[model samples]
Target: MRSKARTQILFFLAASAGVTMFGMYHVLEALGYIAPPRPFGDSIGTVAFGVDIALGVLALALLPSAIHHDPMEVEYGYVGPPSALVACLVILSVWMVSVLAAPAGAIVLISLSARLSLYWTVPAVCASLMSALVYQLTHSPADPNISWSTVLGSVVLTLVLIAMGSVRGLVLRRQAERAKQAKQARQAQSPQQTQSAG
Candidate 1:
């Protein structure tokens, strides 16, 4: 249990650091603190962003399992649910992180809420609102008016991702329940067989 806890803490710390660094890199590049790659160009950056989002999704999706001390002890019907205070802290943390890494942070929030059996809509709505707010705040006065279509697209994308994450969480929970049942059945039969043999 100590080892498992240590592993979980280390994994979370590493993931958080990786996401933060990636986010800061993009922010720096945008601010001209870091130069964009000349040869590979923005394509490489796009690919990297996609990969980061993918990894964030995978990590958040598997977070519930990671939190468990033992899968067999999962009695919450799905994944282990966080306390209200923890949930609030998570939401606030994601919101703050999204300011720098919107896509990855938004997806992480959505997946985390879904996996924890919370109202996924809360994070989805929060993500969409945050995206729009960021866009408005960041929009240059010299640039053309804010594009409503882009904002709408972002909202739609957030919703779709939330839906997908929710579905994935549901599937994972069902699988875990099935595995738990099977293990219990085997354990149940073992004692009966031993008694009969004795």
Candidate 2:
């Protein structure tokens, strides 16, 4: 697949994930105690989605370049310092700001996007937490113990996200490599020779 197409696929995936998150939020809302994680208009949801989609796109764009070439090869990939790393930090910062500053409608925009990193981070944390929960469950008595079902479900979800990230990363890398190879071939072509005999 082309790098651009791979990026588009990832961008689409992130949007779909956002939709899934929204559904979960609604289900929780129906329970009466759950408010929007980041309420739109009043919260950071708008900016969140924007940031998320932006980051995913940016990463997708840059990530492909990085796969086949070194920092020197990928113009976007910086060698001296980790720009993607820094962007992750910025993503988190802006997300917090969006969550605090935006109104309810705008909240959804950046709120979800802001958590883009969490697709990688949150699941790691959640999976670890789930493991601990499971361990505790084993030791506790059946009557007053934590919910095994909930722990197991959360663990399964977390693992799935981790697997998804791995797949996405691999796909992006492969696409990037192919793009790099094609560019190299095009660059390798020598200019046409001109001979004049008088």
TM-score: which candidate is best? 1
> What is the lDDT for 149 in model 1?
77
Whole-model lDDT, model 1: 0.53
lDDT of candidates 1 onward, in order: 0.53, 0.40
Writing each residue's lDDT as its tens digit, candidate 2 over 1-198 gives 225675455445544554465455446655756643322343354454454445434433343222221334233342223343343333332221222111211212222222234443553344345444633443233335676676566555445544554565455557667988898877665332222221
Clash pairs (backbone) in predicted model 1: none
Where model 2 places Cα greater than 4 Å from the true spot, the runs are: 1-123, 126-144, 191-198
Q: Which lDDT tens digits does candidate 1 get at residues 80-198?
A: 33442243334323432233334334445444545645554574466456646554444332444666777677667666766786786667668778988999999999999999999
